[model samples]
Target: MKNLKKYAKAIILLTVIILLVCFSFYKISKSRSSQFFGGLTSHVNTEEKIIALTFDDAPTEYTNEILEILDDKNVKATFFVVGKNFEKYPLEGEAIIENGHEIGNHSYSHQRCIFKSQTFIESEIEKTNTLIHDHGYKGEITFRPPNGKKLFGLPYYLNKNNIKTIMWDVEPDTYVSGDADAIVKYTVENTKPGSIILLHPLNGTAGEADREALPKIIDELKAGGYSFVTVSQLLKYEN
Candidate 1:
């Protein structure tokens, strides 16, 4: 009976330790700033009134609409496009380039990168990079993992290849759901100097609020004397 009780306690302690490790990994995978390896930029550390406006999962049919709003505001933004979507919407991808915006790779299949194999990770990024190059994006190709989730394999591959992972400090669409006004308010309120603002204006109906809020967000930020820059340009201001 004594031995059984000791064994039970040992099992409980083991289970608790396992749970803690799992929980810690979960939090780290979802973290915007922390990673197992490589340089991750959630927001550049600077006091300049300049910010990078990044739209993820792009080159969908809504690309033109988003681009139009940015053009109207005379703002330059970065689009992290998925490989398959970019292929399907070649003209839209071309349009993004034509409009003088920067493009980054957002993976080929847009899958969650945690616990994935290194080969799989490399394939996803390389496939997307190839497509981006084929589409004539000449600027530095940065990367943003799908769903902003990454762990050992993804970060290791990125670090090995010297690819900087671009994350965002401000994500209003995610927190505010489909409320345009709320997105605008949250973004405008949370934005600071050197903030990397993320939006998902290409996500079909779910993204309508973001698309609607884009112009307002830009106008509000510009009103506060914040100038927009691309991800590469924003990196230059990092201290």
Candidate 2:
């Protein structure tokens, strides 16, 4: 009976350890402010009123509309584009580059990138980087995982390739989907100095709220004495 009690205690301890490990990994995978690997930046460290506006999954039909808005506002932002979309709409991708906006890789197939094979992660990052290069974007290419889901393999590959993983400090449209006013309000309220804001202005109808909120967000931030910069430019302020 004593041996059986010892075995029970051992099993309980082992189960507790396994649960702790799994819970730790879960937190690390979804953490925006921390990662197990190198160089994951959600917001820069600065006292200046500078921010970066990052649009994810780019070069869709809404590309020109977004570009035109930014052009009218004379704001330079960053575009984290997928390889498939960039290839599908090379002209649109070039337009973003031509307009002097920074380009970052948003992976090839837009997969989760969690628990993926090393080869799959490599191909996703390398092929997207190559495509971004082919689009005449002569600048440092950062990366943002598809759904902000990355574990060991993705971070390992990004760190190995010397790419900084970009995340966001403010994401309004994600919470207030299809509500432009709410998005604007949320962004204006949440934005701080050196913040990185993520918006999905390139997806189809689902991005309408972001597209509509873009000008308002920009206007409010500009009114609040905030100037926009690309992710790379924002990183320069990091100390």
Candidate 3:
């Protein structure tokens, strides 16, 4: 009876340790700027006074409003549009291209790429790329995982195929209350040479606040003498 009790305690301790190790690996694997394999870049190191403005999600109902602002400022942004959104707003996506902006793949269903199989990762990416192509966008389509969480499968696929993972340095929505003035202020103040600014002004569900922020952010960046480029264009400064 004594030996059985000792063995049972040992088994429990070993199980607890295994669980802790798995949890730690889970967190690290899902990190935005860290991965067990492949290089993860959140910011590019460069001295050139150039920046990239990337918008994620749909070409929502506010697409025309944001487009007008970019047109007025003479700025071109990269839209990391989702496949489902593109299907819903085919016209909007096409207009984005016609206006000389860049497009990227944001996955089909905006699913998190953590602990997923290679087949699932491939489908999420490849299907989105196909949608991007259907929208008349003919440039390099980089990938930005939903919510910036990726793991072994995502990195392995992107690295093997030489696809760049685009992330951001300054996120105004994350700091401000998604107001136009606040968004613009955060962007103008935090921007540096070769910064990547992320904005989520695409989804109509976020209301007019985000839509209003689009032009203000653009005008502010322009006033600061920051030249806006697409994600691929920004990649030219990569070391």
TM-score winner among the candidates?
Answer: 1
CA lDDT, candidate 2, residue 115: 87
Task: Please give, for residues 1-239, the per-residue lDDT of candidate 1 as tens digits.
Answer: 99999999999999999999999999999999889998899999998999999999989999989988999999999999999899899999999998999999999999999889998899999999998888887898999999999989999999999999999999986689899999999999999999999998988998999988999999999999999999999999988
Which sections of candidate 1 miss by over 4 Å?
none
Point to the candidate with the largest lDDT. Answer: 1
Each model's TM-score, in the order given? Answer: 0.98, 0.95, 0.88
Clashing residue pairs in candidate 2 are: none
Candidate-wise lDDT, in order: 0.93, 0.92, 0.81
For candidate 2, the 10 contiguous residues with the lowest summed lDDT are: 129-138
Candidate 1 TM-score versus the reference: 0.98
List where candidate 2 sits over 4 angstroms from the true fold: none
Candidate 3 lDDT over 8-43, as tens digits, reads: 999999999999998987887656577765776667
Q: What is the C-alpha RMSD of each candidate to the true structure, in Å?
A: 0.7, 1.3, 2.4
**Quality of model 2 by C-alpha lDDT:** 0.92
lDDT-wise, the better of 2 and 3 is 2
Worst 10 residues of 3 by lDDT: 202-211
**Error at 164, model 2, angstroms:** 1.1
